[model samples]
Target: MKSEHTETPVTVLGLGRMGSALAGALLAAGHPTTVWNRTPGKADALVARGALRADTVADAVTASDLLVVCVLDHAAVTALLQPVAGQLAGRTLVNLTSGSPEQARETAAWAAGHGIAYLDGGIMTTPEGVGLPTSMILYSGSPEALAAHRGTLAVLGDPIDLGADAGLASLYDAGLLGLMWSVFGGWLHATALVGADGVAAGTFTPVALRWLTTVGGFLDRYAGQIDAGHYPGDDATIDVQLAAVEHLLHAGRERGVDGRLPEFHRELMAKAVAEGNGGDSYARLVDAFRRP
Candidate 1:
């Protein structure tokens, strides 16, 4: 059934957790949502909630000019869409599959070859976070397509346009996930070290959050320093932090906590210092990560 008011008709081609969340958000926001899944059973709940269930992938693709695909991987995306490539011409295909930058670029090229308007997307939150205002959904490809469907897409989350390179969405997603893991590792390590002295996690986390805000400011400054290839030590010197890390190692040793994370940091800082960067800011360590 079509929406009487003609809300931008949309189809979601997967029924996994994240895909279901996306369809739910679109329906919740008044879109005429069509859904399809291989198992058929997966679409039952969505159908009960007023989503039109497409009997086949072709039906789903034909149901809307804007199709959102959130599938298992690049291979699965290929398998699902290749047969229907002809039907997809001139339509906007928003692929939210997780894959490498190269894969995304290749898919964009394939879409371009078929005369389809393609937009590669990265969902920046868990299934539970979908549709929340704070969640960011990154999109890159076919700026014209995004400009046209942005309002409809915003129902899924904040649509962050990363410009026309379809691969940039995947690249940014991978880097962002890496940043998340690094933050998690550092937070867990600190929690364990503090817990050793009987500090409750709940008590320590608020302070840690405030500290992270301050650290975020440092990152803002350091990003520019890195781009300029001139890391100033006006705020704090790598040599000073090098001396401070010894205390952390000592504390971790006394508490029987794992010291590998801090040890790695110490190694990086020491190398920078050895290379005559001791007077530079910690941002100089960015060079340590790069190959000559």
Candidate 2:
């Protein structure tokens, strides 16, 4: 019996870590993958794994109807593709580079001008996570193109279709990064605090992670309050939260932990309460963040 899968010709422009992983995943999934990179050497591993190495960007674009560009940034992607825009006509280009929402919109407009269907994507997984089912990728762009190449794209994991708006993928990426940074910052603060008690990070990590799971529920509740713009002090008011934050700051100082982070929270809450938001929900601090 014939195989159910249909092979698609995919061109991966930029053979950096992420780019190489993408091409390798395509090749592994039995697609014909064409790879091109400025350095040339970066394509060797993919070539060995059955990828066709393109000598020029134009050659890469012309070799495949579905092109995946995972360059350093929007500027690099633009610089590389601008010179070979003619060859990209009648093709679908999926850009997985990290960039601002404005950049994704601009690139979509440019691709449209060249008669190319554009899909802006954001990969949340590391290079090793490519092709794994656990990997998540945010995508927003031409629906027709996505439907046409969804199977080929699914090789990288679940391709989450946000919407037809090209900017949504980048916006999602930015929000996800903000969450990641907040978690990382909290982890660092917690680790340092435990260090003062002669505790190793390895010993404290599991406990901290358990606490994170508990706090995750709080985030779900806070999300509803934030979206509704309802600053109800049913749970805890700004004054009460500020009192707890001050206590945290005091403990941090006493233990010689990093005072800067806890102090910043305490100060922010203090200002919010002083500005007559003492009875408001902690989420009301979103207003302070918006202030200059």
Per-candidate TM-score against the hidden true structure? 0.98, 0.93
Query: Residue-wise lDDT of candidate 1 within 157-238, one digit each (tens)?
Result: 9999999999999999999999999999999999999999999999999999999999999999999999999988999999
Colliding pairs, model 1: none
Top model number, TM-score: 1
Q: Give residue 261's error in model 1 in angstroms.
A: 0.7
The deviation in Å at residue 179 for candidate 1 is 0.3
Over 72-168, each residue of candidate 2 has an lDDT whose tens digit, in order, gives: 9999999999988888999999999999999999999999999999999999989999999889988999999989989889999789999899999
Note the residue pairs that clash in candidate 2. none
Candidate 1 lDDT (Cα, whole model)? 0.95
What's the number of clashes in each of the models? Answer: 0, 0
The runs of at least 3 residues in candidate 1 whose Cα sits more than 4 Å from the true structure, single-residue gaps closed, are 1-4
